[model samples]
Target: MIDYQSGYILRPVNQVFIYFSLFCALMLNLLPIDNYSWVPDWLIICIVFWNIHQHRHVSVILAFGLGLLMDVHNSELLGLHGFSYSLVAYLAISWHRRILPLGLLTQALHLLPLFLMVSLFPVLTHWILSGEMYWSALSAALQALIEALLWPLATVILLAPQRRPIHVDHNRPI
Candidate 1:
């Protein structure tokens, strides 16, 4: 392939794997830990990654539903996560082609803003509505920075199953 991601050809990603990964990420996010601003939203990050790599399987509706589930689980305002997640999905899906061809760290840098938006949008909206604004800017930045820094690692792990070669036929042409 003229523009392959790596030396080995990635296998066709199964729908089941995509959903299972997303589910695992969701479960991780749902753990009852004290809400920390520095903690990255794994669900949103996974959703964004899947949106970029497997948009056909992972769509905005899925993101919206996942966000709503998170909102309910966290006992926060309704539709806040839903709206932000869907927005991120739309942005990812629309720009995925451009993003896919870039280097890993550059991809992280490009996506940093999207992560920041997801981190801050709900908090900012809630603050504005309830009129209790605080220093969320720093927290959102921290969360986004952490997530962005992990993007390359996330990609490596997530893509491993697809990248592993089933058979190496030296005689066969790629």
Candidate 2:
């Protein structure tokens, strides 16, 4: 079992797995079910995870591109998700050095603010621009809560493939 404490090194994440997770997030958003108010944004979560864990492979530009697809997915104004996702990517990249050192629950709690902002950005902008709210305040809050809770779960599942196996080998030293 991999240690949850500090100083435990994870194997390098595969680039293909990173892209696959992002793709799956997009597909989840594209499912035929009607978009619900409380559903968490899988794309945002995945983007944040990869941004924090593998910043070099996943950058702000890619987040913007993914956001564009999300914009189309939700039938929202163009560049809304793009801008928000780009902001998320930028923020995650900026805070990654700090976030990587923290424990799972702490990391999730720290992300709550960012989750709120990403969930509310478009709603706030829409209200400002057209004097209407696309997302109700309660729903946004719920979504943020769900995403925050999912952070720890997402971290574990996404990092599973990258975890190093524990073995007793005196001759081999890390």
Candidate 3:
């Protein structure tokens, strides 16, 4: 079990895990999906997980930085994703104590629309700013649908309890 002492930064291994997860999310975001990308935003999902699990350790500022990096990588309007992600992070952090203790199914169900709402706000902003009201609202709705569906799986996989290691004498090997 990891002992997170008060105000202690994450251990090296944990830091690496966080960085790796974020990097994977970035790669997923950058994946070429042709003209129509059906993928949900992986980084947001990871951010949600981290904030839920360790809000004290990770803050809205981290989410903002990641979101800004994502926008720069994708060449989207600067600060757009940053603002949206920071908002989401704040929501998650504020609700962390309440939400993190719930059962997985309940948590997922509860957070589905919350995630959708966060995602939709940015999309709406993007659409209005770009003056490209071309895509129907259904398109954004569908993306949120996919994201909602994936959230439970993401939480389970990322936060699943790992088996503990056992000690055995080498001489006892069969």
Candidate 4:
């Protein structure tokens, strides 16, 4: 169990698990799902989850690096995902303390705007550059909606190890 009064202390192994999860999410995001491809923003979801729960471990630089990698993988305009993800990381870290005390549903509600910002920033940038709004922006909004709906499940899966009961050797000397 975590010592809440002293703050959560993550072991080295836990840190590796978190990064490994993010890698898996990146691979999952790269899958070819046809029209349903936009249904899940796996990388953004993972980044947001970690930033909120373990902000000290997940930094905005890491988020920006992952976003750059995502842009390369998707053949998108470079720096688009980087900027959006960094923004999401910043917002998540900013609001984490307030959101931490809320129920899962309420937390998801609060994150909706952040997720929308993450999804729409690239589209808005493109519109500004081209002077035309693409209908594809609607898909980003739908993706945000899906992500918000799935936030609770993501939290449960990602944070499960942290919530596990720790075995203390009481016989050991203090």
Q: What TM-score, computed on C-alpha atoms, does each candidate reach?
A: 0.91, 0.91, 0.76, 0.85
Model 2 poorest 10 in a row by lDDT: 1-10
Q: Candidate 2: where is the Cα deviation over 4 Å?
A: 1-6, 134-138, 169-174
For each candidate in the order shown, give its overall lDDT on alpha carbons: 0.88, 0.87, 0.70, 0.84
Candidate 2 vs candidate 4: the lDDT winner is: 2
Q: Each model's number of backbone clashes?
A: 0, 0, 0, 1
Model 4: per-residue Cα lDDT at residue 150: 95
- Kindly list the per-residue Cα lDDT of model 2 for residues 118-161, writing each as its tens digit: 98888788889999765445478778889999999999899889
Writing each residue's lDDT as its tens digit, candidate 4 over 90-118 gives: 99999988888778889999999999998
Q: How far out, in Å, is residue 20 in model 3? A: 1.6
Best by TM-score: 1
Error of 3 at 146 (Å): 1.8
Off by over 4 Å in 1: 1-7, 136-138, 164-167, 170-174
Better of 3 and 4 by TM-score: 4
Q: Ranking under TM-score, best-scoring first?
A: 1, 2, 4, 3
- Model 2 CA RMSD to the hidden true structure, in angstroms: 2.4
Query: Model 1: per-residue lDDT, tens digit, 1-174?
Result: 112456666778988999999999999998888788777899988999999988989999999999999999988799999999999999999999999889899999999999999888977887889898787455777888999999998998888777756677788775
Scored by lDDT, model 2 comes in at 0.87
In model 4, what is the error at residue 88, expressed in angstroms? 0.6
Best by lDDT: 1
RMSD (CA, angstroms), candidate 3: 6.1
The residue pairs that clash in candidate 4, if any, are 1-166
